[model samples]
Target: MTADPIDQALFPPFDDAAGFDRIRADLGAFLPAIRAVCERHGLAASGLAAFERGTNVVVSNDAGQIIKLFPPFLRHQFEAERLALGRVHGNVPVATPEILREGELDGWPYLVMSRLPGRTLEEVWPALGGAERAEALARIGEIMTAAHALPTGGLESLDLGWDAFVERQIAGCEGRHRRMRLPERLIAQIPAYLASARPLLPTSVIPVLLTGEYTPENLLVTQTGGAWRVTGMIDFADACLGPAEYDLLGPCLFLAAGSAELQRAFLVACGTGIADADLTPALSRKLMALALLHRYSNLGYQVRIEGWESQASSLSALEQLIWPFPVR
Candidate 1:
């Protein structure tokens, strides 16, 4: 039997120290061969630039299509993204890439998807004023609410069930933070804090599909009638079935950035009334603990939180640091 060409290509584990650098190098070396595969499938590569910002080797062309290639070791991400994009298409207001084709090329799994039109929110956020940012954040909140309301039937087959997933995170909370080099004071409080807050974790609310990273980078924005609005949501590789609050961590921590007004606008749009007391100290602590336990949580990569180090003396202080009350 002949070996698959993709199988013959050397690829590192997902967590290899060199990570995407190694993948990019290998992909560059194999570009001619990859381009041949695309040509065979009627996707022309002339004058097209490949976008390598993410872990995968992705290319888009004038034909309004995105071609994403995943190494065999990262096939799970391919499957998750393909399934998520298909499931969420047309069901939510915000646009999502539609899967046009999916298969393996020389052992590398690939998905060809329709291109979504809009600029990433991160690109436009800095120019917007406070009111404009708030409006966009509130619209994002509404989009998230709609996404969470979608049925989870298609995602049930994913490897980790919600309860077991939370349990795993709970068990690893302390060690995970330690590896991320979280402050010693915060690290020491994790175990007992999580133990006391376990009951408050979203076991009671009906589980919903969480697009784990809702930060500006994953959102697309465009001006509609002179107002900036979120037009599309992308990158479902981290999607999972979890509590809605767990999904809010990205927007709250990254987008709102302790702005009480922005946070209120977001929560109000999500239909969670904006009482200052709603995010009580206990609830805030629980959410912060859960933030640390999030699937992709790592303070090492979240350089924004470094600014709070001087103020995070206690849990209450940490909450204030991450989600301060609005100024009068």
Candidate 2:
């Protein structure tokens, strides 16, 4: 409708950029623009390289820092991340990014933060042994536990009220899943299943900050005496405030890969014990509803376990399959 203002020689031709495909398709093209932000901030000599993962424009260098950019339409994520990193930095067990500088570039907001060490758990999960995986999940649980315990009295930016958020998600649950091409079997059960699970969810529980970013993608791991450990956590752009269980969906469905032992370890360490009489089944049901309601939920893509589709004949079946746990 109007003229593009960014220097074409530097920034990608992001005109009418509706989806991430354009960015992902030619990520290198945006490096000049990425560097322009650095140049503006006087950190341009650090030699940049693009990280080819996830949505968003990201680049890092050997200067012990990284830069992340959120498109104009996604500026809310930039604000959310900036606030989240500050709130949980020293409070959580694992290391989180420390913001060094932040500013907007031609309508795209960017943050230059202290880069954390260790490979991402997503990069190493497939190779880790049983014990290492267990330990990693356990550590993740601890980080989450500490986060949930932090005071949430006045952080309105992070508090995505669980009630209203869920209401909206429920309203569009069927349509969202349908658009995502979820199987008709699961799609058909959305209404009654969520209604049945409503009694299991909390209406008055103390709200906690929810990052929804604890998956292998965000978790960093390093070896400690031959065992992998979750050393750092990143990507807080999707952070919000909500019921604690809502945060667990990422770890349970993504990193645990539907394993009873690993999922139970994570849930237990997260302070929601999976043992009998500890509300595992009820909690599992609650999380299932959350899995559908998550802002970025795409079950078919996020859940990593093989054969899950075959096992998930219904919503209840899916919950049990992913959260069998120490319930037995």
Candidate 3:
């Protein structure tokens, strides 16, 4: 007998190494659970539907509200998120979702937030030209700097120490990539590559509020004066304290999408100048290692370069594959 699938579950399956295929498969039952939450919280539930994005059981309501229900295992993200919203509201150039309330639901923790405005930059990227893409990238870069420039007052409480986090990531880098199905050719050289790149990660600088994924999907943009501009940044659940450069890898790879010119625009705007020829190689390798070690790194989708597995003979070549230029 197949016990009712959704009824058979105690909580959302742990967001562990296995991932979330089952949740999506049983979304119909999940919707009712969300509706119950909405009913209890007194938030609109008329149009509630699974948001169908990211790792959690996120659902949206008609009243410009989003409710993200995190599994017990991802409770750390819940903590990081509530703190992040309060801190970013008035401090940064853009707006993050305002937390209306937070509490437990059927043993799961959840947050109800006021959704911000503008279409995700990702939804509009394919329609944007080179000049428009460059403009959007540059604006997002400045916003990143502004967010990073703020004093890390209470953010340190995220409790993810940089030294330990980097060491943990460095130690697990090889195993992680192997599981993520990185090609053998590239996987073989990870140890030697990370050894050289280790020194490039800075330990002494004042830590910045490091958002996990800084790509266009998290950035909101609107057409302003006939040019698209970044309006707001969203999704801080996976955020914590880390090096500012750690935040750049996503946008550099996903937003730039293998264009050296765009990569240069963003890196320069973020205040990491690449004009000096000597800095590019070192920067490239450091970012490559971080990309592999990223908490949510998935090279399958993040690596946009086609035929890269066959083309990139070594980690250095793969770095060039992503950065795509010697100097700009």
Candidate 4:
């Protein structure tokens, strides 16, 4: 789960009575469609329960795991997903969602994953205060570090060249922008940013540990015996093979929960020494700008046009990601 910049501001309250009612209403309409699919796949007895893990999750006992449904444009994301999950299968101390089946129902493709047992970090984040929050983040850092520590040869091979990768991302953004009916000014900034930034990209490349989405929402924390450990790292649908620096950017935005020191701690845990060159304020700015541009130009536009209230807050978060400095 990557942080939705607009998640907090734009989504309906999930814990509230009204919000749950709305959820049940949507589930009512979707369940039958899902049930039909499950039957086709021979998992009919799988009773489904909705989860609040930053995306729509339906869990069924007989179905083997939870099933995730994203809008159509995201169908292409599954390739990166299977690859990421394969990388983390045993080395990382996390449960990767198992993709049992995938296909479109009512025109939207979905992935059914094996469910892991535990509550989401969101359920406990608020109760945790200063040090406790730090501990939780440390645990998350450790899990992510273990993930990055694993060999990258498999992920590396799937790498689309940087130039082609950027072009595809830009095209995706442009298509979504056109569909969302965004303000022309926002639409116009797309090509201008690409024109300026694409030229500055380095000629070389590096192996990256990519888990495309790395936000608190996608993380599941549970207690084993007495200590807390990261139980699951779900939703790899957007996983990509790109710059090593790119992997840490999302945790810097949402998982650190706005704490610079925590973000530093996470980098340290990953064991990939934080290069002074990469941490320069200018570099952070470049990464942040690219992140926002990518979201607004592509992912953000997808959520807006799809009218998915849960991810609306993601758009707002983009502002924070782009400008971590205090306003003058």
Candidate 5:
């Protein structure tokens, strides 16, 4: 019987440096294959760096070109990113890197893209204080608004409707929860939320531009002259077509100091359709709760499977909130 190529990559003993070394050795067999492709595409001279953080082998060079090798099992994800990038081309709110190469390297799916120009906004956010932070957030709202305004009409294959997005989220929760051996109760609650919140979900989600992962890691802010504008928005790996309100939640949860006022301003700028009066601590409460639930599910799976400890812990902290359940 033949083993699945992706399963092989997935089961690799990836731990710390020693495990990563073995993984790298395994990848070395495919390096030559990738090298040949890069050379053929005239990308031979690109400076190379490998970020062994996530599921894929994320590689980039000095030229700002990135090559993300998706595990054989995640071929669909590779296609999704490529498709989303294509949809946003020339229509993106801010400059986005161009996809240069997309195909398989040996048996692994790989995506090569020209690098966006700028530093991560995460690094910039800390330097600015109250007023500047407020102003930066407003700009952030504008960026999101611009992205949501992109025309989705006549683009069916690329369109990520609300139903599909909700289904994916539910599936994601179920998959991770099962993997982590998380409490069955939490998993059971998801269906209830989905059934009850289905109506509310669409109401909150005004379809515009949906970049699925709105985390700070994917955002790039560049300074031109003395003005700092959002120069590049990278990583369309999770980009989808969905509600604009859902999109603003990223900044609300991860950026914006988790402030109600800032969140209100963001919703307004992004044209999220949520009235200022609707902005309340209640919204933050939901974000905080959902954040924790996701963190627990992700971490539980990671820990149960002996996956990346740091990654699991990172996600665990993402949902930090006052919990009645004691930390075991």
Candidate 6:
């Protein structure tokens, strides 16, 4: 059986980063074909802008809808995202995009979702006062706590059970950091550190749906009553079933940016207690290990961490700098 021309045209091998860049640079070449697909499904394609942060072809249409098209290799992401949005609908306090339509177009899976309200949290973070930033972080913490409290019934469909996922990540922990060109000294210690910490890791717990990327970019905030509040939580493409701590990596490393006050507010809001002593060094180490093992934990891709170069001498130092727990 021959593949359809549209499928053949839209599909690109995942290994070719340059090829993906070329497609993004000249999105016009693919717009006509994408427009045809959207029109066939009764979605207007005008006002399309390629969402630059992601690897896939994601664009927002004039109708206040986001249409994300995934190549064959990334079809799992489409399925995971669709299932996540559906399962979390009406279950949490924050607004989540409603899946309007989902189907395969020329072998490329696409999902049309309602465009969420408010600007992304990252857009407003730099302009906020200390009080506003703290309030926003607390609100985010609350939202995350509520999200993690939801039942994980339908999430198993993603086939990423917690124990298996952790084991897999642990096995590849060293190699992944090595490939990311981590310093030789730190890379050498990763294996022993991870092995020693394996027993400390959670093997069994009530699994919660993990929004693997809980950074500011995925959180939408709006100013109301003279305070910043999280209005919506978007982008669950990397959602998985895992321990609650996994969700905190982004907020700690990226959003809070080593702010003790913000981290305290976040923890207090999450009902994890306000004392710095609450975040024990061992627990901090485990969470730090998980952060390093995160699927997208490549320093080359995370420009935000570049600012900490002077403070971080090794992986351990970097972890301590990003998530400083009081020394006993």
lDDT (Cα atoms) of all candidates against the true structure: 0.73, 0.80, 0.77, 0.57, 0.57, 0.74
Better-scoring candidate (lDDT), 2 or 5: 2
lDDT of 3 at 228: 83
Query: How far does residue 235 in candidate 6 sit from its true spot (Å)?
Result: 1.3
Model 3, 1-328: lDDT tens digits are 1112233244444355356645643556477667666767788877767766676777777899988877767788888888777777778777778888787765567888888889988899889999988888888788788777777787778746878887888888888888899888888899898888888876765678877757778888878788888888888888787778888888887888678888877888885544546446777777887888787777877886778778889988888888765665
Looking at candidate 2, the ten consecutive residues that score lowest on lDDT are 1-10
Model 4, residue 270: C-alpha shift (Å) = 2.4
Error of 3 at 236 (Å): 0.9
lDDT tens digits, residue span 1-328, model 2: 1123566576666556554646753647877777777777778546678787756788887787888888777888888888888889999989999998888767777888998999988888889888878888888888998888877666687777777877888999999999888899999999999999888776765788877788888888888887778889999988888778778888888877768778777777885544435646777788888888888889999878787888889988888877774455
Two-way lDDT contest, 5 vs 6, winner: 6
In what order do the candidates fall by TM-score, top score first? 2, 3, 6, 1, 5, 4
- RMSD list, candidates in order: 3.4, 3.3, 4.6, 10.1, 8.1, 3.2
For residues 1-328, write the lDDT of model 5, one tens digit per residue.
Answer: 1122333433344456455545653445446544655775678545666664454567776776887776556665676677778777677567877888776644667778887778877678667666665666677777776677777654455456666555666667666666676465555565554454344445334456477655566777877776566667777666556655556556655565434455555555665655665554344434433433332334332221222333323222322322111212
Model 1: CA > 4 A from native: 1-17, 25-27, 271-277, 303-306, 325-328
Please, what is the TM-score per model?
Answer: 0.87, 0.91, 0.89, 0.63, 0.69, 0.88
Q: What is the lDDT of residue 120 in candidate 1?
A: 86
lDDT of 4 by residue, 37-85 (tens): 5665777545666653343434454545665555444455655666777
**Residue 93 C-alpha lDDT in model 1:** 78
Best by TM-score: 2
The per-candidate count of clashes, in order, stands at 1, 1, 0, 11, 7, 0
Question: For model 6, how does the per-residue alpha-carbon lDDT over 1-328 read when each residue is reduced to its tens digit?
Answer: 1124564554444456557666753466568656756776788878887777776787887889988777767777887898788878788888999988877767777887899889988898888999888887888788787778877776787645678778788788779988888767777788777877677777776677877656888889877887778889888888877777777778877777666666676766773333556766676677678776777877544525556756676767776776666533
